[model samples]
Target: MTALDNSPNKIPSVTLDDVDSSVYSLYEKREKIFTRSIEGFFQNVRLFTGWPLLLGYFLTPWIMIDGRQAILFDLAARKFHIFWLTFWPQDFGFLAWALMIAAFTLFFITTLLGRVWCGYTCPQTVWTAIFMWAEQVAEGERHQRINLQKAPWSLEKVFKRFTKHGMWMGFAALTGLTFVSYFYGVRALVTDVWHFKLADTALFWSVFFTIATYANAGWLREQVCLHMCPYARFQSAMLDEDTLVVSYDPQRGELRGPRKRNADPDTLGLGACIDCFLCVQVCPTGIDIRDGLQYECINCAICIDACDSIMAKMNYAPGLISYTTENKLAGRGRTWKRPKLVGYGLAVILMITLFSYSLFTRMPLELDIMRNRGELYHEVADGLIRNTYLVKIINMDRKTHTYQLALSGLPAPRMVPDARIVAPAGEVVELSIDVLVDPDKLIEVNTEIEFRVETDDSLWYATSESRYLGPEPIRSQNND
Candidate 1:
C-alpha cells in the first residue's frame, strides 16, 4: 500500500493493485489462546510428577561425586561423566545403545497409551504449564486474561504484562543457566555468573537457551507441539486402534443439550453432555474432543477434568470424556495382546541388556598404532629392518598411569626409547618409536605385528595390530 517516494514529486510504485491479495499468502496470522485453568485427578498427577523432574534438572549439577560434578558432559574435554562412569569418544557405542533404547521405549509407550509422555512429562508441556500458571497469577483467570488482552494500553495492563513477562524471563534464565551448569561446574557457574566471568561459549549458549525457552514456552506454546515438533507428525504411525487416548464418548455425550436441574434425558431427548463448551475452554491445544481423534490432542485430559466436573454438578455420571480406546468407543473389546507392543518392549529390553553388558565391560585405555607411510622399511646400521610407528595412547581414567609398549608376533625386535611412557589422566599422549628387527626374522614381507601397551601395575592392557614391512623371503622369490 505504501512505498518510499524519494523523487521530487510523490509517486506510487511497486503496486499490487492488479493482484488479488486473498489468492496467496506466505504468512498465516496466529490466534492468541487463553486457556482456562481446571483441577482434577490428572492435574494433581501432573503436578506431583512434574516437580521431581524440575527439581532434578535444577539440582543434579550441584551434586559432587569424587571431587567432581556428579553428572557432566564436558565438551571441551570430550568426556561425559555420569554418576559412576565416565564416557569417552571411544565409548560411542554406549550412547548409541542408550538412544535406541529410549526410542523403543517411546514407541512402546505410544502404542499403549498414546502421547502420555507429551501430556505428563514433556519439557514443552511442563514449562508451558508453569508459564501459564505464572500468567494466571499475574493477569488473573481466563476471562480476566481475555479482557486484559483486548483492553487498550493502560497503566494496569502494562503492570500485569511486565510482571508476567518478568516471571517468564526469570524462569527462562534459570533454565538456561541450569543447562550450562551441566557442562560447567555448578559452583563455578554460580561464581562466574555472580562475577560476570563466564566464558564466551557459556555466555552465548546461556543467552541462546534463555531466548529459546522464553520463545518456546511463553509465546509459541502450543504452536511448538502443533507445528514444529516432529514427534507430533509421526505419532499416528505409532498409534493403534486399541491405544488408549483422551476421548469423548459421543455415544453418551452426543445429541448434546442443556437442561434444568432434575431433568430427565428420555423426556428431554438429549444425551448426558450439557454442551457447555468448557472442554474447549480448558484445552491447551484448543481442539474439540467431539471432533474425533486428532493428532493435535496431547492426551493432557484437562478437558476431561472439565467435563467430569460439569457432569458431577449436574448429578450425572462422570467419564463423558476419558482415556478410552477407539475399539472401546466403537462398542468393541480392546485386548492387551498386541504384537507391536510386544516387539517394541522386546527391542527396548534387548538394547538395555546390550548397553548394560557393554558398560560393565568397558576399558578406560586406548592404543592406536600409526605407522610412518613415507618409508615402508629401511636397513639399519646392523642389517636390521627398521619400521617407525607412532603409538597414540589415551588415558581415559581419573589418575595418571605409566605404560610400557612391547612388540609381539615378530622375533627379537627392539623398540627405541624402551622406557615406560607416562600418560596423564584424561589426556592423549603420542610416542614416536622405531621397531628394529633382525633380517633373519623376516619370514615374509608385510608380516603381521601386534603392539601391546600395558600398565606397569598390570592393571590395563591394549593391543593394536599393524603390518611390519620387511624383505620378501628368499625361498618365496626362488619359487616365483
Candidate 2:
C-alpha cells in the first residue's frame, strides 16, 4: 500500500485536453425558436381575454374624471388620482398594502392555477402575442420565416425584415406613449407628441420604455420566459400535486407512434398520441410536453390546443395534453384542501378586506403639530404662559378648506392672533401660532392638550395631541 499505486484507477486525474472545457464556460450561445401558431379552445379564450385588457390599457389614460385625468399618477405633484379617489404622499402606505395584496393574490392564483397569469394576462405575454402577430403579418408563417432566416440576404429579405422591425418599433412607441400618459395627462402628452415637444423626462422614459418593449417582445420573446424571469425559476416552490397545470397524460399517450387516421390504437398497440410533434412546434419555449413538467412551460395551453386539434383530426379522444392536476393524472382523487393553498387564499382575502376598510375610512385631511424647541414656555404680560407651535395642515381633498382651529385641556386658552387656517387643495400649509394659557390654570409643568381642526364646508375634522409647557405651580407660602 505504501508503494503508491500509480495505476489509472488508483490515481485518477483529468487531463486538460480530456476535460470538457465548454462545460466550464459561463455563457452559452442561444438558439432562436420560431413558435408555430395554432387554434383551439384555449387559444380562442386567450385571444378574447386579451382584447379587453388591451383596450383598457390603451384607453384608460384618456378617460376623464371630475375634470382631471382618471387614473393619473402625478409624481411631480405627489398626488395619485384614481377615478373618484385621490392619494397624497402620506397615503404611500396604502400603496404598499395594495402591492402586498396583489402579490398575495398572485401567489394564491399560482397555487390554484399554475402560471395562467404568465401565459395570458402578463404584460410580456400580451405584448409578445401582439409582436408575434405583427411578425406573422410581415414575414408570413413559421416555416416561411424559418426559410427566410436560412436563405442568403436578398432584396425581399431586407424588405420583409425592415417592415417587421418597423411595425414592432411603431407598436413599441405606442406602448411607451401609453405608459407615460399615466404620469403625464394623456391630452397633454398627445399634444406634446403632435408638436414633437415632449418634456425631457417624458421623452427619456418614452424612449426607454419603447426600447425595452421592442427588445422584450420582438427579440427576447421566449428567452424572457426561459432565462430572464425569476418566476420561471421559483414557480416550483409554489406548486404542489393538487395544483392544476398543463400536462400530458402519459397513461393514455405513452406508446406514441404515427398511424392511419382510422387505425385502431388497441390492435396496433399504439396510443392516442400520433407523435406529430405539433405540441413542440407550437410551443413558444421549444420544449416537449411528453417529457413531463418543466420550468420552461408557461402553461399557455397552446400545446393543449395543438394536441386537441390533432386528436380531433385523427378521430381520437382529445386531451392527450391538457390542463390537469398531478394527483388526478396519477389516479389520486383531486383535493383542494391543501394547507398552503388555503393559507394563501385566506391571506389574500384578509389583505383585500383590510385594504378596502382602510381606504373607506381614510381621512381627507392630515395635521402635525411641532413645538418650537428654542423655548418651552414664555412668560408675558397679563399672567399668561405662551407656547409656540408650528402647525402643519395638509388638505387631501379636491377643494380648498378653511379650517377653524380650537384648543382644549386648559381653561381660557386662546390663540395669540387667529384660530383660522386656510389650506389649498393638495397643499401643505405650515402656520406658526402662540398658544396662551392663564397661569392660574397651570397645575403642572407640562399639560396634555388637543388641537382640533374642522373644515367649514364639510364634516371633515382632524385632531393632533400635543403637550403645553407651563411654569411650575407656585407653592403656597405656608408650605414653603
Candidate 3:
C-alpha cells in the first residue's frame, strides 16, 4: 500500500463552505409574541379572579393583626407569624405538612380540571395578564404593536416603548417589595425603600425578585410556561382522557374553508370553522388549538371564547373549541370514578386531614432540660448532694406566662431560689437551676428526673426529662 501524506504543510487549505454550519448553532432565535386583546367569558373570569388575587397579595402584608404584621415570616428570628398563630423552628413539621397538602391538592385539581392553576391562578399568568394589560394601554392592539416593532424608531415609538417599560418595571418593583414584605415587615420594608436604607441581604432579594418578575411576566411570558416550568413537563402524567381541558373539535371543524357569513356551511362542505384565525391571534402561547392538545397549551380557554364569538357572528353553533374531555370528543361517556382521579382525591383529603389534626393539637409551650456537663455532682455542707441543670422554656402563646417549676421522681428535693419564672410571649428563657438531694437518698450513679412548668393560670403545662448525676451508692461497710 502507498503511504498517504501525513505532514500538515502538505495538506491543502479548506474553505469555509467545507465545514458543516449546523454544528455551530446553539439555540433557535426567539420570536416575539404579540398577544391580541379579546374579551369573552374566560377573559371576564380571569379579570374577576386576577383582581382579587392581586388585592390579597398587595394588602395582606400591610394588615396588622394583634399588634403585629398579619403574615410575617421573620426569618432572621426563625419565627413565622400568621395572623394570631406563631410558628418556631421546632414547628417546621407543620410547614412540611402544609406543603405536602398543597402539592396533593394541586395534583387533585389537575386530575380533574386540567391546568386551571396555570391559566388563572399561577403567579406567572396573573402577572403576565397585568403586564399585557399595561402593554395594551401603552401600545394599542396586536397589529399596532407588530407594525410598531417593524417600523423605524421615532419619537412616538420611543415614548410608547419607554412608557410601557417604565410601567412594567414599576409594577415588578412593587411585586418584589410585596413579596419581601412577607419575610420582612411591610412597614419596615416601606421605610427602608423610601430612605434607601435596605440591608444588603434585603436589597439583594428585592432586586432579584424584581428582575425575575420583569423578565418572566413582561418579556418571557409564554416561554416560561413552555420551557422553564417543570410542571408543564410532568402534567401529562397527571392527566387522563376524562380530564377537562381546552380542546378543539376536529370532527365538527374539519373541511375548514372561508365562507360568507350567511352561507350554509353544510352545503359548502365546510365545518363550523370560519378560518378567521382569531383563536390563533388571541392565544398567548401563539399555538393553534385546532392542531390538537399541545404541552404549550395553558388551558386558558381564550380560544374557546374567540371561537364562540366568531360562531355567533357567523350564525353557527358554538363549541367548535371548548373545555371538554378527550373521551367526550371521541363520542364516549366520561365518568369521575377513574382510578387515578380517585386516588389523587383521596391523597389530598388525607393530607388535609393530617394538617388539620397537627394544627389543632400543637402545643403552646415547649421546655428543654440540660444537665450541667462540667461537674457531675457537688457535695456541699451536711453531706447533701447537689446537681446543676440548665433549663430552657419557650412560650409559644400570645400572652406572657409566669411558669411555676417543680421537680418529680425525688422526695423533698430542695430547689435553690424561687421556682417561679417569667417568660414573654414568643420568647425563650434560659435559667440555671440547682437541686439539692439528701445523701441518704443517693441510690444510683444517675437518677431519672422530670421537670414540669405550669403557667400561673394553670391553663398550660410543659415537661422535660433529664438525668441527675450522683456518686456511686456505697454498700454498708459491714459487708466489706
lDDT of every predicted structure (CA atoms) = 0.88, 0.87, 0.87
Q: How many collisions between residues are there in candidate 1?
A: 0
- Cα distance off (Å), candidate 3, residue 64: 0.8
Candidate 2: give the clashing pairs: none
Per-residue alpha-carbon lDDT of model 3 for 1-480, expressed as tens digits?
Answer: 111111111113344598587665466556677777788999999988888999999999989988899899999989899999999999999989888888888988999999999999998999999999999999988768877887899999999999999999999999998999999899999898899999889999999999999999999999999999999999999999999999999889988888888789889988888777788878888888888999999999988898899999998888999999999999999897898889988988888888888888877899999999999899998888999999999999888989999999775788886568999999999999899988666666788889999989888799999988877665433246
- Which candidate leads in TM-score? 3
lDDT of 1 by residue, 1-480 (tens): 112111111122334676587775586567677788999999999998789989999999988888999999998889999987788988898888888888899999999999999999999999999999999999998778877877999999999999999999999999999999998878889999999999999999999999999999999999999999999999899888899899999889878987886677778889988777788878888788888899989999898898999988888889999999999989999887899888898888888888888777777899999999999898988888899999999988888899989889888889997989999877899988999988775687888989999988878899999999988865666668
Quote each prediction's TM-score.
Answer: 0.90, 0.90, 0.93
Better of 1 and 3 by TM-score: 3
Where in model 1 is the C-alpha error above 4 Å? 1-27, 374-383, 399-404, 421-424, 455-460, 471-480
Quality of model 2 by C-alpha lDDT: 0.87
